[model samples]
Target: MSKISFEGIGEVAATFACEAEVQAGQVVGLTGDGTVGPCESGGRICGVALSSEDGYAAVQIGGLCRVAKTGEEVTPGFAKLSADGTGGMKKDEAGGTEYLVLRVESDGMVIRL
Candidate 1:
């Protein structure tokens, strides 16, 4: 059997139409209409919005990005994170996606997607 493994090269970002108003630095998810919008609690995260302009947003899909927290203290290290339902991230103990948390600051935490 042939084996193959895929790894992301580097930071990846893409532009997408917004389903609704999205601010920069907010975590977004794919909407039913194929547009991007603020991710709801426990929703599958698509990427972090780097900029929002003209009904569109530039989202970072890979590599390190800063994300707002849901006021829950999370120790810096490896942990699972999920949407906070209001454009922020939270420590998900209930089988969420895992990411490497590089640092925890008062504003937000740096995570490698």
Candidate 2:
């Protein structure tokens, strides 16, 4: 397995749409207004999923998830994908602070942001 970084609207868009631009196992760092928006269906940028089986255009934040999806889910408004020292960033302060724990696998764990 390998790790990758995805930034800006396009990369996030590709992941959200589950397009060929992205694939499983690639960690995406999302940053863009289009990557976030309000969804009447799920409220706020609650989660991400594929728009369709063959749609290139991914729904920014909460566009309207039509399919039932299951995968590693993350939401922090904006972030950068890193493969070391947990799934999130390092602490700038003296003490060690942490967020985003990396999990290898789970059958069906539910999380909220």
Candidate 3:
């Protein structure tokens, strides 16, 4: 699998709302139903609800459905934001990994990578 670094993203001040359109009524510390990653690697961290405000905003490190208990896939989404406001998902075919489609509506800036 292809791995991306979360540290590359700068820093963002926001919280998570624990709600996802993909998942229904299943809320966790960080909803896997939505997208989370560094805002510098080409990803946008929005609330995905009403507006891009409120809730815990996170970075889009990578995308993986099922919960990773083994820790092998325990790569949690980073919470950093880059001032450049450039971040998004990248297709890594060489790594046999497809960054799932995730759109959040938190309170983070959208950085274009």
Please name the candidate that would achieve the greatest TM-score relative to the true structure.
1
Whole-model Cα lDDT of every candidate shown, in order: 0.82, 0.28, 0.27
- Off by more than 4 A, model 1: 1-9
Clashing pairs in 1: none
The TM-score of predicted model 2 comes to 0.23
Q: lDDT per residue, candidate 3, 1-113, as tens digits?
A: 22543322333333344333322111122324543322332222332221222333433222222211110121223323211222222332233222222222232222222
| Per-model TM values vs. the true structure | 0.84, 0.23, 0.20
Cα lDDT tens digits, model 2, 33-109, are: 33322222212232343343353334323221211223234343232222222222221223322223222223221
Off by over 4 Å in 3: 1-50, 54-85, 99-113
Best-first order by lDDT: 1, 2, 3
Q: Which ten residues in a row have the lowest lDDT in candidate 2?
A: 104-113
Name the lDDT value of residue 71 in candidate 2.
Answer: 26
Per-residue lDDT of 1-113 in model 1, one digit per residue for the tens? Answer: 21521223367999899866789989999885657998889877999988898888888899877788875688878988899988888998885798888777786777888
Candidate 1 vs candidate 2: the TM-score winner is 1
Q: Candidate 3 at 4: error in angstroms?
A: 33
In order, how many clashes per candidate?
A: 0, 0, 31
lDDT preference between candidates 1 and 2, better one: 1
